[model samples]
Target: MKEKFNEAAFKERLEAQTSFPTLYPFKFIVPKKSLAELKALFPNRQLVFKDSSKGNYTSVSFQLMVPNSERILEVYRKAATVEGLIAL
Candidate 1:
């Protein structure tokens, strides 16, 4: 998946050594309707939402501190097992 960055924020974060940055692209078998579940699963992670289609689907860009990769992977793995979630 392609990404668009918040350049200034990314640069600042990178310089600060606060978080490891990565582009995690996910897929959803069904269009996203409720993000509350995802939010609950990742309370401290940064999540960026985007539209994949005007009226049908969506794509989410999730950014998290590098340490959280395992945690994030846990969430993604679980979600992927669910009816609608996928990793792109």
Candidate 2:
């Protein structure tokens, strides 16, 4: 089962822990078929990818300098639209 996510609390935590305009890392595991879609979300950013042993999924990771927690949240919100994506 998926754990519940409290957006407000997450935003608060991010604000408390992070400084603005800093490099933030994002990682996700997604089905191979969804790779293109995920890549589209972060055009021009350098993304490191690793294929799963079975070759059905790939782990994608990257970092970007963001203005604030809201920017990070916005990327997550957009990434949520990609099917079978799991953020880590």
Top-TM-score structure, candidate number: 2
- Candidate 1: regions farther than 4 A off: 1-30, 67-72
Cα deviation of 55, candidate 2, in Å: 1.0
Q: Write out the backbone clash pairs for model 1.
A: none
Error of 2 at 76 (Å): 0.4
* TM-scores, one per candidate: 0.46, 0.93
lDDT of 2 by residue, 1-88 (tens): 9788899999999999998889999999999999999999889999999999999999999998999999999988989899999988
lDDT of model 1 at position 44: 71
TM-score of model 2 (CA atoms): 0.93
How large is the C-alpha RMSD of every model relative to the true structure? 9.2, 1.0
Q: Which ten residues in a row have the lowest lDDT in candidate 1?
A: 21-30
